[model samples]
Target chain A: MGKIRTRLGDGSFIELLEEEIYEDLVDGTQDAAQKGRIPPLSEDELRYLLDLYKSKARVVGVDEGHECCLSYDNMTSKIERAHISVSKFQQLQLFERALGADTLELAHIDYSYKQVKHVVIYDKPNMEQAVLLTIPPMLYGAMPNLGLYTYPDGPCPNPGDLLPQGKFDEAKEAYAQAIELAIKDMIFVGSELYEAGADGINFDTTGAAGDAEFYAALKAAETLKAKYPKMGIEMGMAGEFILGMHGEIEYEGVRLAGLYPHDQVKLAQKAGVTIFGPVVNTGTNESLPWNLARSVTFTKACSEASEIPLHANLGMGVGGVPLNIMPPLDALSRASKAHVELCRLDGL
Target chain B: MHAAHSIASGMGGMRTTGDLVARLQLNKGMRIEQAKQYVADKLKVPVTDLADSVTMGEMREDLNIGVVNEAPGVAKGIDAKFRIAELLDLDINCVDMFKDRVKP
Candidate 1:
């Protein structure tokens, strides 16, 4: 039998035997099931993947609704990084006029709220046309970073050094301190941006540093929402499951660690998040069929449970899209289509 | 410059074939030599030609997967992926199923 052409989760082009495809689908579903404790794809859904791969068309599309609007996390910075040499506002204009992005985010290259807190003056001029000021609640980038708490840089003993000595409490104490610092920075930056004529504030890539980071974002969101009732806030998650890096962190009585997208959305709503971007990590070795099925299943549940708009994170290494920095459109379109069609997505 | 080129510039230049070779090595566990050979076979180019940016640039332009230099109004980003899908004969499963369910 001839091999069917397909792409790996990393967006690498490859061909595989029919049996290999089946094996990948099963493995991918089981992987998601084990990790999230969620139901696997139904047999019919699995058959859909098998038939889709066996189809003759190379590139494919939905007959309708592929032209849906998009919302971006770090819109202007991505344009500037591409060496576009345009002003930040012009980059937003380009996305609106050329790329048709419905909503745009104006952000600094540093990309973290702690870093952007010092640069809101520069970002203020770019606030027009439904633009949100975006920044990550990057606990890892905060002052006295975990590294600073350890080693030659600071007076405190190194956590890594302490961990081997069974100083788990010391290591966790350092993380707890970092989370408090990050929350302050996020609230400060978000308030500064909101006051500067911005339409919204996006806490991009929340939970990247795990539960402590997620806690900081939720707390910051709660504070900011109470302060400015009209300011739109979007919390885009870093992964499907919040990592238990600082496993003891809680937001509003619900523990932050190990919460899946469905559960995560509930916390976001309680914290007054206006939009939620739930991510499903892609497996580099799995086929797109497996990845998309897994991502959709998780995101569908998230969308159903979400009170806010569900802007599923459909980008590199997440959302069943390939891990390519410039994700090939085949995967992007297919992933977007599936999320919109199968899941109740507001934007990609 | 085409808008897609502008978008592609920051996201990393049209390194589609090179990216493919690298992913095969990194993800598929192919050795460097094996990955290069595999990419060469799929792309129908000489193995040595893979590293030649000038040659690869033209090949990418021709293939419409993406290009180091922009060809005005041609594919890039999502448009490029459409061409890549057909050129590479990739089965984007969602696309296939959607087409089947919707077609006359």
Candidate 2:
């Protein structure tokens, strides 16, 4: 395994460890943060403790929300629901905070840091909407050309009024600029991350981009993938919401129903996406004993569509926490077993 | 001049000498010389280490934070991804790397 040396609180460098005790420490930290327990460490102290902790721990990439946090509807519509909303600068601040963290050990345990650090970016479906944040001022000047549905608190456009209605020039230019702004934002707040080591910049697109803006986002992804060939942008095609058995389809005059992204996987591959298989959602009625049968059918649909690897998104909804957290223990136990049993699932 | 600054700024913000002196005394109960040495020690350099370009993340990390919880979904994400890595036989070290080079 490759190694990363993290400077500890005492200014001693230790090999950064990934996983093992990291889960418990982070869980405890979240619990503490929630219960008003962990006090703010002075920046130096935070830096030292974070590095010491970073040396040993393994965990997943955390995402509070994608477009859900940055979009206009996210601010107005979901505000009452307690959804998170933050600007690009705020996101840059968050990235700094997270890097300072990097799965540090709180209690006594030995875990080493691995050399490779993962930087995955999710642009909600048509991340083109990102320009709405009023960032980079240049965007403010080039506003009309970007092809966003609407700006924050601005008038919504009727589909008829959306200019050029999917024309390449104006919309594409705006998308390219949006992505550039995103990258620039990342660099502005944290340049050392790129310099620290070769970070794998996985530019994954989601269904949140949807049909209206997906092509624009994908074009940007393709351009980025071409530019930064080393980061190797991977495509994560978000599947359409299908109700599984409750949904219906007819093939060869026979009616059949289940869950799947259907032919959408082909569209992703055709768009130069290396990673196939659209992400399958559980369903509308997210009830207990989550329709395991439907999940199997959904997986089968994705499998039939592509031979590429799959990341089974395990959580459905963790009701009532404002932010989704803590899947039902029973459901999680079953999901764990399913993850192990499904050899085809390369990840979650 | 450099010696005076040594006791200053590193405590973060409040660039004035008097502010630095007051802050050091209030927090660490130390004199200017002691604070200067503390800065040097933190920098792992001599008292006359001077100045250099600091990265963006470094500057933010040096600033104060009320609490340092991991980003929003990071804790749970780690747990989920770790299990996924174990089951998939993928490298747990890199979140972006899966299936040899593909990031899931």
Candidate 3:
């Protein structure tokens, strides 16, 4: 029997017998369905991943019409880490002209709306170039980092520090205060960057701080859209399931905490997000087939439910790709292909 | 400095200090030892502190070079690199560009 080439969730290479592939795929899909309370993949979807692994080609890609554009979350910051000496504008240009990114973002190293608010004046020149110079659309991206409001950073007490002390009301109040502060900062910075010539504002890594953070992003996006009807907003999630740090928080009458991607995209749509980037975290202990199957199942549900375009996150440690810093292209490409083919995704 | 850095590098493919050192070596074409010495001098610490996570952690917290346990109000990820560029006096292209373009 021919050994089928595959990878583990860490991006390590391994080979499996042909018979083992079916079992792995089924286990992956079933796990996702049970966890998310969604349907498992049908036989046809399983066949696509099966053929992808069994194919002789080393790497895989989407068919002609199935291709999707990519929207990178932290454009400028990642460039500074990799390149020895590339100007932020030059790095953007490389992404635009050289790399052909469909959408480019201008972000501060801090990667948070509150932090970027302080530096937007310094970023105006870069934002202008991002809009005027680049052929693709440009966005100003940042996290709604509500954590900055906690003690040692801002006036509020840390919820993590308080909850253990039997101070539930205080913790909830802290998150609530942080939400208001974050909403204000996001609006102020989003408006400033939008005025500076950005095509959109991206709330990258939304809901990372918890339901309160998710609530803030939704409120900010709604307010920003009301102000600039033409502006595009993309919300990329930090995880598949929204953590219920502030368990009772709600947006549009839907509870924000403990939401899976399928439900998460609905709130995003109501908030007028132009693109929804849903995340399905990769399981490090699982096989690539297992991870990819689970990722595709969740993403497919998200795409179906989403009225806006779906740009599922396909980066390392999420979207069924491995947890490696540089995720192996074999697994990455196959996962991307499966997402595009099975999930009907608009972008990555 | 020598043994410490190599041991840390072995833990993960590349971390903050390791990444910075490797970048210096590749970009400046310095020998590994020369690159280590250069980073050590720039950060204003003993050479051995480069790989000493505890010392580097404190130093990173102070300098905003990058912190492992990220907290609020601290420089992180790429934000740390901006400080690194200014302190190290290295020619990071984007930082130089931002400096040139900042409005007054």
Instruction: Supply every candidate's count of residue pairs whose N, Cα or C atoms clash at under 3 angstroms.
Output: 2, 18, 3
Measured as a fraction from 0 to 1, the native contacts recovered by model 2 come to: 0.01
Model 3, residue B64: what's the lDDT? 68
Candidate achieving the largest lDDT: 3
lDDT of 1 at A96: 41
Per residue, candidate 2 scores C-alpha lDDT tens digits across A245-264 of: 11122322322222234344
Lowest lDDT block of 10, candidate 2 chain A: A64-73
C-alpha RMSD of candidate 1: 16.4
Mark the regions of model 2 whose C-alpha exceeds 4 Å error after superposition.
A1-149, A153-198, A203-205, A237-262, A270-277, A284-290, A318-324, B1-104
Where model 1 places Cα greater than 4 Å from the true spot, the runs are: A55-59, A63-68, A128-164, B1-104
For candidate 3, what is the recovered fraction of reference interface contacts? 0.00
Report the C-alpha displacement of residue A184, candidate 1, in angstroms: 1.2
Best by TM-score: 3
Per-residue lDDT tens digits of candidate 1, residues A1-348?
A: 889888989888889898887777777777776777777777776666666667665344433322222456667677788897897756655654455233446777777776666776666544422222111110111121223323464444555565577878987887766666777777887776666545457887888767877887888889988997756677888888888865777887888889999999999889877767899999898789789878877887787787666667887899887898887765666666556766746545
DockQ, model 3, C-alpha based: 0.01
Write one digit per residue (lDDT tens) for candidate 3, span A232-287: 78899999999999899888899887899999999988987877889999988888
DockQ of model 2 vs. true complex: 0.02
Note the B-chain TM-score for every model.
Answer: 0.60, 0.29, 0.74
TM-score, second chain, candidate 2: 0.29
Off by over 4 Å in 3: B1-104
The interface root-mean-square deviations, each candidate in sequence, come to 18.7, 23.4, 18.1
Candidate 2, CAPRI quality class derived from DockQ:
incorrect
Candidate 3 clash pair list: A87-B93, A87-B94, A88-B94
